[model samples]
Target: MKRPIILLMGTMIFGILLSVLISVLFYGKNEVSNSIDAGTKKIVQKEDKDPYEKVDKTSPTISVYNSSTNKIEEMDIETFLYGVLSAEMSSDFSEEALKAQAVAARTYIIYKKENNMTKGHKGADICTDSNHCQAYFSYNELKKNKGEDWIKESYPKIKKAVDDTKGHILTYDEKAILPLYFSTSSGKTENCEEVFSSQYPYLKSVSSPYEEQSPRYYTETKISKYKFVNALNKSYSNISLSVDNLINQINVLERTNAGSVKTIQIGDKKLSGRNIRTLFGLNSSNFDIGFENDTVVFKVKGYGHGVGMSQWGAEGMAQKNYKYYDILCHYYTGIEIKDIY
Candidate 1:
């Protein structure tokens, strides 16, 4: 009876040891799995944080490629606008016109930056080339053009224009529009489809009768027949034409909705109006060609592509007591002015 009781006690001890071993193995595996899960969650949380979370979205600093210096300069948005405004428009323009320019320029840079349309410029959001991006004027340049006293007087006005329209941008369908402004118009703005391949509703043709007030409204460029033929040959090497053939064949075939030339037949070689303008260094495509005493005379009626906002037209409206918002609305059809901030 004692032996049987001892054997029973040993069996009970063995069963207790086996239960403890199983519990230890299962608990150890579960703890490791829970730790791994906790670590993975921590990694995910860290990865989700945005680097620019603390940045000010309203007024971000931009990198400008100074083409003259071949250097990248960092500048605040408003400060950059001061340089652009000084270079783009004359200080003699009215306060309202300056204000309109400020808003348009601000919108333009914002659009360019957002779209990464800097044309592969390294480490720069924009360039100082007016043909590529927008023109910029340094303080010294402004002083040289307008004198120190005038800069002191006009700088504040330009700053006021930028300040008054701070964070303001033109939007179409709640997105920022590509606000393009030119020196002057040919009494009307061209549709986007006429100049560019894309058609934009807000960039439609609009009458701008006030641009005649601009000093650059009308310009005349003259090229001799020999020079004209030489330029054409340089552009189109295969073209074999005499001055007489050019004179007889070179005629405006079609005009855009805004009265700018669409196409011109130059000795059986059809060239775009823009191409002719570039080849001859003409001011704008809105031109009339004529032969005057062995010279090819081009009478240009505008100072730019005849699209988007006309800067001189804005000045004219401002001179007539129109507000900045009114000028913007007139130029950019069916658009809303909103504060980005």
Candidate 2:
């Protein structure tokens, strides 16, 4: 009986050991699985921590003030550029000239945005008024202006020019430049100091012999001698006008380096040529006065302020096979083309 009892005790001990071994194996497998799951969860949490890790850096949007509607509109930069290009430059220009205009327009706005110079406009980065900011023509307006077929043909070309030179801007010394462009020039572009209060090294005088292609290169407007004197007196209240004083006394007192009249002596008062141009509705400051019969003839040369890039000159250069960058560099003077994106 004692031997049978001892054998029974040994069998019970073996059963207990087998049960403990099974529990240990099961626990070890479950621990390995839990560790793998925890590691995967940690990796996922890490990835989710940075929300902007895969955000797109390009295609930024801007806020514009629609002067016509008197409302603020938000749109993508590229879309805004389409309107600007359409209104600012004619689609008939060469692709390279259009591209150069695109870069210049982009640089101008970016510079304005960077400087926070919105001219007191509320809740907007820029405006649609071309005189104030940059000119903008909506797709519908462009269709109306050019017709459906012309829009279909020309819009793609304009889009190509804009897209091919995407994010390109002019930079002087690694900073954005305030690129001022105009319709045409006399034989040369004027220095910044000559036109505006501030002087810019890049805005120095440069010969633009190619601008003769512009329709406004040579224009003449005739006004009666009495009307001319009255208009001058209206602008400059100090000026005393009469037929005898106006005959030989009215002459250009000073001229800019580019040959645009800088100052004019009318009767006893001396006025800026720009003032005279504005008073008489002249095309440009470059003008010569003559008395023909009963009319005072004013022969004007070029158009606009003639302070920077000449659009007609740009088109002429493009016709001569100059690339967009080449045209920009020639006009801007010691500048670099940079991709902001």
**Which candidate achieves the best TM-score against the true structure?**
2
Supply the global lDDT for candidate 1: 0.81
Report the error of model 1 at residue 316, Å: 0.8
Give the CA lDDT, 0 to 100, for residue 318 in model 1: 78
Model 2: lDDT of residue 206:
75
Report model 2's TM-score to 2 decimal places: 0.82
Q: Against the hidden true structure, what lDDT does model 2 obtain?
A: 0.80
lDDT of 1 at 328: 85
Model 2 clash number: 0
Q: What is the C-alpha lDDT of each candidate?
A: 0.81, 0.80
Model 1: per-residue Cα lDDT over 129-150, one tens digit each: 8878889988788889789898
Q: Per-residue CA lDDT of candidate 2, range 1-341, in tens? A: 99999999999999999999999876643412211121112101111121112223486788899998899999888788988998899999998799989989888878888888877457688889887888998898989988999788999988888887777888888889989999988878888898889998778777775778899999999999888878877766888877664677787889987888999888889888898888788889989998887789999999999887889988977776666776777777777888876
